[model samples]
Target: MTEKRSPWRAIVLVSTISSYIVGGTVGGVFLGLWLGNQFGAKPFFLITFLLFGLATGFYGVYRAIEPFIGDEKKR
Candidate 1:
């Protein structure tokens, strides 16, 4: 069986993926900055959280896309 893909699907997927990565990174940076400032250890926490964010963001993308992948596999 063949599946028909919508043009908007690509747009939405790209947007959602970008949002996942960007949102996680930006949110983490801000939160880390705030916490670092509170703790008086700016760079350390900021760097750590930024890496954490990167990991979380990619993991989120994988999770978000996993169902689609499963569907394709079943087909």
Candidate 2:
């Protein structure tokens, strides 16, 4: 029999995923800004960061629901 997961585990996982994605987005934006200066390109660092955050958020939501879908298939 599979062990049951606590509600806190689900909460923590979701929070962790969201945080990591947001942080990665910020880092990417900063990198873009720096590289843009080096290459003399007009880099829209803010736009990149926002898009990353948006994409990651969608992924996070998908991940959050994935466990439910998997659990159902096992039944």
Candidate 3:
């Protein structure tokens, strides 16, 4: 039998993924600032945030696709 997903699942999934994206941004900029201050790095915040966003975005996309890609399709 095929499994079914509750409509709420999409809402929850979107919310969760949005948070991850936000976290990546925060981590990149804040972490960069702190580390840069301590190590005198240039554009630390910007660079960190950029890289973090890329990685986090990819991860988020992968996770978002899980339901659709899983062995059992949820209707």
Candidate 4:
């Protein structure tokens, strides 16, 4: 028999995933900004780091959700 997933589990999963993406992006941007300020190359560093953060965030989301995707496919 199929069992219902707990709401708490879903909430936690969503929260975790969102946190991962947001954290990566924010961290990257801030770090880039700081570095850029030091180097006096604001836009260059900011854009580079922003893109890197976006890639990292997406990758994290993909990895985190992969298992769930596999499970759904099996069913």
The candidate maximizing lDDT is 4
Off by over 4 Å in 1: 1-3, 70-75
- Clash count of each predicted structure: 0, 0, 0, 0
Looking at candidate 2, the ten consecutive residues that score lowest on lDDT are 41-50
TM-score of candidate 3 relative to the true fold: 0.68
* lDDT of every predicted structure (CA atoms): 0.84, 0.68, 0.73, 0.85
TM-score of each: 0.83, 0.55, 0.68, 0.85
Instruction: Quote the positional error of residue 65 for candidate 3 in Å.
Output: 2.8
TM-score of 4: 0.85
Please list the residue runs of candidate 4 whose C-alpha ends up more than 4 Å from where it truly belongs after superposition.
1-4
RMSD of candidate 3 to true structure, Å:
3.6
User: After best superposition, candidate 1 residue 63: deviation in angstroms?
Assistant: 1.0
- State the local distance difference test value for candidate 4: 0.85
Predicted candidate 3 versus true structure: per-residue lDDT over 1-75, tens digit per residue:
222457776677787777877877777777777878888884966697669876987698678767667536432
- Candidate 4 lDDT over 10-70, as tens digits, reads 7877987998889889988998999999999999999999889988988998888776775
> lDDT per residue, candidate 2, 1-75, as tens digits?
244467777787778777767766776677667766776773575566557766776687677666766665676
Superior candidate under lDDT, 3 versus 4:
4
Model 3 lDDT on a 0 to 1 scale: 0.73
